[model samples]
Structure formats: structure tokens, C-alpha cells
Target chain A: MSDSLFENLRLELRRGCLTLAVLANLRTERYGYTLRKALEEAGLEMDEGTLYPLLRRLEGQGLLASEWREENKRRKRFYRLTPDGERMFDHLAAELQRINASLERIIAEAHA
Target chain B: MTTLFERYLHAVGEALPKDVVAADVTAEIADDLHSRAEEREAELGRELTDEEAAAILREYGDPRVVAARYGRVQSLIGPELLPYYWSTLTLALVVVVALELVVGGISAIVRADGLRFFSALDVAVHSLVWVFTIVTVIFAAAERVPQGRQRLARVMRWDPRALAAPSALPPVARSSSLAEFIANTLALLVLLDARGAHRVPLDRLVATMLSDLHLTLTVAWQPALVGTAVGAALVAIAAMIAFLRPQAAVVHEMLRMLGSVVAIVGLAMTLASGPLFDPGGGIATTIGYVTLGAAIAVLAVQAVLSVRALLVRAPMPTPKSARG
Candidate 1:
């Protein structure tokens, strides 16, 4: 009914997906801008501001590893999934798939 | 001129925590901004304006909010300590108000002096500010304290059983509950007894209290006296409502406000009598002083309960969901 309410619900729904996407994409080491561009190319557009902080937080939680490395004469922080992060990403992806399957079944039954 | 890119980088760095590597972070941001500006220029086939660069920075949102996303949750008073903070602050402030009133009342009675409005107000304001500041500082420090140390005592353990317990008693309605009916009836009886309307006669009650005091009980005294009676009547009505509809939240809040008004009126009546001391020390003066003390005590309890009521949220019954 309200635009603000819709935006809030959208934000909440995106929060879980964002974490999963970030983890999955960080399997290969990439700097902040490149990771964001990769995600955007795959249809999940993320703000640079939101993604950078998230990378830092995931690194802090020990799920992602990062280091400052110079590339093309400019230094940038590169992030990639750790072994722990890979395991976490697999677990989360499985859980999300289960939830989506239940929703699909319910929708199909309702339509029938 | 400091380039727009440098200024934006500076703003972001300023909001970041001190522990963050400022130089590395700013350098990364500067490169990212350069790429973004180049993209915009390529699309337009021209270099970006200062205003356009400023727009990009604004689009990133408040630097503080952006920076906060990189840190742990920030709050002046964290959720865990909020309830305790309010309780300590409310209790301290209520006690301070009571002590001020008692001291003022007793001083006036002993001196046989009239209670001046401005001076009494001055004392109340000063005491309130002092109590508020001290309580806030202590609780704020508790909230800011890092983990790994016990801020509260060991007695405040996290027990699952506490979750199932009802934190506060429901509000009293006049008709639905027996206990509420009795409580309200008893309070009314106390009001009548204080007036001596049910027993020793009104004049004797008036004469006994008034003769020792240096007050010319005029038509002005009538308002507060009448107000006490009216407040008592409202309390009786509130009790009846409780007896009828114990579930009505709004009505109970209204009754509580009425009760507060009544207590305030009663206090006004005591002040209107001037100093409570009987010039001639006798049985009448002793009775008068005790009665004054009891009245002040009742007002203090009401004030504290009102503060409690304000703090606690009354849960309303939920309506049925559309899905059902």
C-alpha cells in the first residue's frame, strides 16, 4: 500500500540473498569494484557502499580473507572465501534451496 | 583546489573508526571514485562537473551510516541494559521528589511559615536535574562498557523462567475484579475518614487540624477540599470501571491520570493551610502533623506508581489475521 513499506520489505528479503551471493562470489579473489561488477553482470546489482562494508564484516567473522595488494599501480583490498566460508556458503545455499522448494510446491498446489 | 574525489575520500575517512587503516581505505575509495567518474564521462563524452561529483558522494548516503555498517552495532543505551536503566532512574527521581516534598513540608511546619510557590518550585527543579544527571551518567557508562566483565551483579542472571513470568500486574478496573473493587472502596473510605465525614464530625476534624496552624481558612481552602472529594469520587468510578471491564486499557490510563490529579489537589490543600504546626503544642497539633505526614506519603506512592505505569506498556489484544 505504501512505497516505504514496500522498500522495507524488499530490503529485508534481499538481506539473506545478499549474504549468500557475497559468499558464493568470493570463491575467487577479487577487489571490491570487480566483485560488485561481477554480481551486477549476473543480475544482482549491489551498491558499492553496502558491498564493501559487508566484505569487511564477513572478513571480521573469519568467513572471508582479505589483503591489501597493489594492482596496475594502485593498491586495493582483495577478498576471497576461506575454507570456513566455502563450507558456510554450501550450508546456506542448501537451506535456501529447501525453503524455495517448499514455496514452489505451495504455489503450484494453490494454482492447481 | 582539493579535488571533489579527495574531499569525498576525506569525508568517508573522517566517519571511519580510528582503528581502521585510513590511508589504505582512502586510497581504495579514491581509485573507485576515479573509475566511477570515468564511466560517467564516457557515457556523456565530457569530463564530470564538481556538482556531479558531489551528487555521487551524496548518493552514497550519510558517511556516518556508511561507516557504521563497517562496525559493530552502535547505541547510546543497548537493549539489554535499557529496562534496568529506566527503573534505576525512575526510582531515584521519584525518591528525590518525595524527599524534597517531605523536607519542605516539615520545614514549613516547624517554622510556621507559609510555603512560597517560587522557592518550592526552585527546590523541585534543582533536585530533579541533579538526580537525572547522576542516574543517566551511571547507566550510560554501563551501556558503553565492553563485554567480558560483569556490569550488573551476579543476582541478575539470565534465567529462561523469567521470560514466562508476567512482569507487571494488569490495571485495576472498577466492576470486573473483586480485588480492584475492594482496593478502590478502601481508598474512598480513607478519603472519608480523613474528612472525618463518617465519624468525629467535619468541624471537629477541621478545628483539630486548623486551630494550631496560622491559616485563615477562607473560600480558597474550599476548592482543594472539594477537589479531594471529587478525586475520591473519580477513583471510586475508576474502581467500578475496573470491576466492569478489567480488559480496557485506555480507561485505566484515564483513571490513573485522574488519580494523579486528585493527589496533586490534596497536596494543594495541605499547602493552602500554610505551615502544618500547631502554635500551641497539644494533642490536636500532634494529630495534625501525623495526618500531614500520611497525606504526603500517599502522594509520594501515587507519584511513584504513576511513573511505573508510564514506563510499562499495556498489551492490547490482537485482532484476527486476514488469512484465518
Candidate 2:
């Protein structure tokens, strides 16, 4: 039961972080394959099932943009952050830092 | 010559909603899967086997689940109002059952035939389905409206002061029991109305109804009707027995549940035989479809509830000393 509880909480925590991570990674124009590989290398592995749908939702929300192009005689769809996405990414990044600092202070005070 | 990759993509596309940009999604996924496979091939310095390729698809997830994620199927009935939805449904079902039984009992006494009561039951079953559907639709719509959701959530939230005091179970009313017994006895006689038996007056009522609705049943319907009659007879017998011996409550419930299963099978056979109404296009046909659908749904719910009662152990009488 505790393991299940932790898993539920872990998913809840990861849900928001994932959106931010995807936005951060997509600041550079990268296809689904390369973007996933980059994030995995950065220790933020995500399932293809999850990553692709997230990309679609972000695109639908106008936070990201995509287009199809050919490379090495194969068709691929590449995605990048839009202007609004870039702005939102900056705002969220700042919010994360503020939250981290507050958490650190609280932990230090408790220890002291 | 469809490759495993193409077959996987096809399966995903099949699961997606028709309105979605399935082509674009499939194309993107196709490219990504191919890229990954190619990368692996490059590392191994050889073409991958079909089993190896299938392993990757397996890791991806079930096609339908993946498609559903893309659809982002939000809950129609949100978590906040779920408890209220269930409570309301249970209340509605109880009221419907009580009202139907009482009406059926009264109708049987007046008409001097049990089929009259069963006719009332037929209407009750159909109405129950409509009630269920409307309630669900209303709650689902309410969930979409923020203000409505908040109001409903507030209303549903329990207060300490509002809690009812603990009370003992009420005694059974003998009058209601007698009424049910009479109704069941009448129903049995009417259902058993076959060759060399007194013809029930219900045939004329049924004929008039069919004529009004512009329906003409084929000879095939006779067997189905007979099957349902047999099932209803079983239920009636069970009810009459229960009324006489209250201690046989568990047996009564089980028998009733069994009767319902038989009745459901009979109803299904009726549907499988083909259209009950003659070939036509009008409001009557529409009504017929809705009535059939609702009746089936109502019976299915009845069967499920019976099973649930048995699972939870139906209320058995205990001696006063044992009650302590």
C-alpha cells in the first residue's frame, strides 16, 4: 500500500516536471526520436507513448510548433518551442527556483 | 507484405478517433520507430529479427491505451461528485423498485390477471433505464460547469450535525406481504395460461397495444414469449414462497436472481429473432427500439443487484439473544 502511495505521489510530482522538461528540451528544433534520446541521456527517461502525446497536447495549446521534413531519405516531424512557450518556460523555471530555495530554507531551519 | 512496424502503426491508427489527425500522428510515430530500429541495427551491425522489433512495440504500450492517451479522455463524472452520483442512483433505483411492485400489486388485484401487473413492470423497467441515463447525463454535464460542480459538491459535503442517529431495523409490514403474494399468484396463473387453461384477458390488451403501435409480431415471437413467461413464473413462485416463509430470505433472493437470469436470456432470444415490429419508419419504431434497450438494461441491473445482495449476505433473521 505504501509503495502504491509513493508511486501515485511520484507520478503526480513528475507530471508537471515533465511538461517543463519537454518545453526546455524543445527550445532547440528536434524530432520526436532525437528529443526523447536527449532527455533520456539527461536522466529524464520518458515512454514514447507519453512523450508523443505530450508533444501533441503542447502543440494543441499553442506552446509548441511542429512541421514535417525529410532527412536521409526518410520523413520526420520536428518540434520547437514557440514564442509563448519560451516565455512560459522562463516563468516556470523562475517559479521552480523560488520553490527550491524556500524548501532548502525550511529544511535547514528544521535541522538547526 | 506488411512489416511488423507497419502492422503496429496500423493498429494504433485503427484505435484513434476518426476526427483526429491520425495520418500525421501515424507518420510521426512511424518515423520515430524506424529511426530507433535503424540506430539499434547500426549498433549491432545487423538487421533486427521480427521478435526483437516486436519487443520494442510491446514496450511502447497497447495501441488502444496509447490512442486513449492521445484523445485525453477526461472523466465525464469527476471525482468530487462521484459519491453523490452513486447515492442518487441507489435512491432512484430503490424508489423505482418499490413503486413498480406496489403498482404491479394493485393492478393485478383490479384486472384479475397478473399480466396486467407484469405490463406495469415492463413500463417500470424501461422508465428505470431512462432515469439512469438522464441522471448520468445531468451529472456529467454538471461536472463540465465549474459553478454547477461547486454547488453540487457543496450540497453533497456531509456535516457532523446532519448525521442521523443509529436506529434498529424496522419490522416488515404484513399488509404489503399479503399484497405481493396475491400479485405473484395472479401472475403465475396468467403466465400458465396455455392450452386447456382459462384464456387471460391480457391478449386483447396486447393486441390493442400492437395495433396502436403499428407492430405485427411474427410466429417466431411465440417461443420467446413462452420462455419469458416460464422465467416470470419462477420469480412469482419464489416471491410467494418468501412471503409465506420469511426465514427463507436467502433462498428467495437466490431463486429470484436465477429467475432474472432466465428472463434475461429469454429477452435476448426475443431480440436475436429480429425486429419485433413490422418493417416501418416512424415514431413507433423509435419508441420500440428505446423500449427494448431500456428493458434489457433494467433486467441486467436487477440481476447485478441480486448478485451483490448475495455477495454481501442478505439480511438473515437472528434471535434477540444472538443480536447482542
Best by lDDT: 2
lDDT of 2 by residue, B1-324 (tens): 129989888999999966588989999988888888888789989988988898878887888887777764457787878889977875676456546655664445444465566677688789779779988988988886658888887777889768543223232244654575567556555654421223677756666777786776554344444555555655665555555455445656677787778767766776666666675546766675577567678878988987876666335455699768
Q: Where is model 1 chain A poorest over a 10-residue stretch in terms of lDDT?
A: A48-57
After TM-score superposition, what is the CA distance of residue A19 in candidate 1 from its true location, in Å?
A: 1.4
Candidate 2, overall lDDT?
0.74
Please provide, for model 1 over B159-215, each residue's C-alpha lDDT reduced to its tens digit, 9 standing for 90 to 100: 764543332457554345555546654544343344323342554666665655553
Error of 1 at A88 (Å): 1.6
Off by more than 4 A, model 1:
A102-112, B114-121, B130-135, B148-324
Each candidate's lDDT (Cα)? 0.66, 0.74
| Candidate 2 wrong stretches, greater than 4 Å | A105-112, B108-130, B137-324
TM-scores, chain A, per candidate? 0.92, 0.91
